[model samples]
Target: MSAQNTQSGKNDKVDDVSGIETTGHEWDGIQELNNPLPRWWLWCFYLTIIWGIGYSVAYPAWPLINGATEGLLGYSTRGEVAQDIDEFREASAARDAQLASADLDTLRENEDLFRYAVSSGGSVFRNNCSQCHGSGAAGAKGYPNLLDDDWLWGGSMEDIAYTVRHGIRNDVDDDARYSEMPAFGELLEKEEITALVEHVRSLSGEEFDAAVAAPGAELYADNCSSCHGDAGLGDRDQGAPNLADAIWLYGGDREALTDTITNARFGVMPPWGTRLTEAQVQAVSAYVHQLGGGEEPAN
Candidate 1:
């Protein structure tokens, strides 16, 4: 007999013991039993197939060239998120209006507005300003640190706001605080620049060779004093940095000072006035003002 029940001849012989019709095909003389599947199991299998088809039709399914099918319901996660954001913006509308118009001078006097500004400004700073200035506003070598009192331009509330509004050394805004330091490398000899570097370092109370700094003084008086002042105390009006103080923007080392004087640093800051909203500018100004470096407005 074949292993499978594929016998073609009429062989409806009954098993002598069970009296059930047997398949002629057999293995080792054992007959095969013919049975039908349980009705319950077949019904369950059909129901699952129907459910899958219905689900695919109701929701997003089937990939297309442009995108997935939008489905009959037309629901989207992006739309839900946008709705939530719109609701939040609507709730803050009044506060935002007050913030936009409030005077910067007395903003801190109002506890509510002050807190709002600082909080909002912090978020703005992290999002926009953190790339240059650190997340904590400590700043990098080229950037000015917000935590310290040292400022190239004045750090008063009015001054900070003005700088933020117009920026420094930027070409986009005509009102930007414009000042240029001549690249001494082109004008002065190599020895003269080195001597100037030594003199500059000595002014900060660092150890220096007096012999070399002697001639450098005359050079500094003629070339740099007009902007840096006679005592190296820096002129805020001109945005010249103070050399006499210990705080150094780039670095205090010989190499750093040498580079600055030789090639000069022409750093540019973007004018926030054109980029941000009036309220946003005010908020960031308020946040920076509270950072310890900020000064009281001049009397």
Candidate 2:
């Protein structure tokens, strides 16, 4: 009788209305449902699993003790990078080819090529030169402005190229551009330096006491006129700065002038020749020359 009762109880546990079974667990007298997953949800989950397997087989996805998977296609990140570079070079092949053959003058003559070179060179300049020459190319108190007409060295395309290729004041390089302004303080007396400063101020048409500059004129001719010329126009090859010009590479202040005379300042621009390829140097030179205020010097 007990066995029959147990069998009847098991039959009673099954739902009569639906064939779906319960979870066989209950909370607070409520049984949990064991419904099948929705068709769409199940399909999406299956698709992801299959896609993950395919991806793992096709590319480097698996990890091992030594390295990641080689995958079936045998692709490499380095190969992809090289391919990208080759594609870019191919697209700009004409410009690159022209740059290889063209001289600075020829490159400057072509408006399209010049524009392209300048744009590229400007970015390079900012990376390299902006530390000394401000981002705007205005330059610091000690450095010379690139945009201004006043250049310590000749502003010709070749000159600019040389400066970039071999940096000035670079001790490591023997070919680096270098020039030292004379330390006049060692040679001249305090009164004489004062007079000379007054004279220099007069040349620039800045306010200077005539009494002071009168003594300074004699000092100027004897000491400064050799390299700076009698009129203070300066020597291009020697990179002497014109004293008569309003623009001052270093500040025009008296203290600044005194400092220069006391201890000569050597502004060094590195030579790009050793650091960059010929093509890159050419591009940079062309860009600097075209920066406003550069032109053919009067004969």
Candidate 3:
């Protein structure tokens, strides 16, 4: 009734059929064969070890206390990339100089330079201005549409360039374009604000209760007309938007209009003068101007 194998002595014997030695280890009376690895595979394994050692000595592979080990070749991928960038910039220097200095009025005469500015500016816009202005430059609720003629500031290339360089309502730059709209909720009663909102809506041709808008007209004249103009045409000098036009920055809806009047809006744009090169500013301006909204410079 014993469970142990009685043929344990045969486990270590060479297989007579295959003439191969057995490993002497067995499971359930099965024996494992002892076989050497192929010579080609063994040689490949040795070659890999040699390659790893050679690579460590010839390339920047090992880390050191302060930096990485400058291998025998002393090569750096980052340095090579930087060198390539410098070469590219050097090649484009002359074109950039022309773009930076060319008068805004005369820029259109040089077709090649104008095209270059627009192309370069498109790249700059994507990197810097696209977050707020959108990839297509259509703009959002609070942001002004670059494809429209309703510019808060002037729409000329020079004006656009100036605005881009100095920015709007940012405190960091002293030369930044600044404007403030008083929060009328603090100065007027709820009834007066409601009436004024109706009157403002009427200016844009929105249907409103005639009785409500009548009182609102007086309130608008007393509080908003100076900067917005008596006809609501807007003053470019003060950066007042044309309320009569269909374009609305925040929204033209009643609730959105109410919130804007109650809280007031002070949208701030970061100055790009300190952030971007003068040439870059010019390029971006050109790109924006060509977006079908730009106007001829005023004589």
lDDT of 2 at 287: 74
Q: What's the lDDT of the predicted structure labeled candidate 3?
A: 0.89
lDDT string, candidate 3, 60-156, tens digits: 9999899898889989999999999999889999999989898877788999999999999999999999999999999998888899888898999
lDDT (C-alpha, whole model) for all candidates: 0.85, 0.78, 0.89
lDDT of 1 by residue, 57-105 (tens): 8777789999888778877778899999899878877887888898888
Q: Kindly provide the TM-score of model 2 when superposed on the true structure, using C-alpha atoms.
A: 0.70
Residue 215, candidate 3: C-alpha displacement in angstroms: 1.2
Worst 10 residues of 2 by lDDT: 1-10
* Model 1 error, position 147 (Å): 0.5
Error of 1 at 288 (Å): 1.2
Q: Which ranges in model 1 have alpha carbons more than 4 Å from their true place?
A: 1-68
List the candidate 2 regions with Cα displacement exceeding 4 Å: 1-94, 297-299
Q: Candidate 2 on 45-150: residue-level lDDT in tens?
A: 9999999999899989889999899899988898899999899768877786787567775565688888877886787788877888889888878888899888
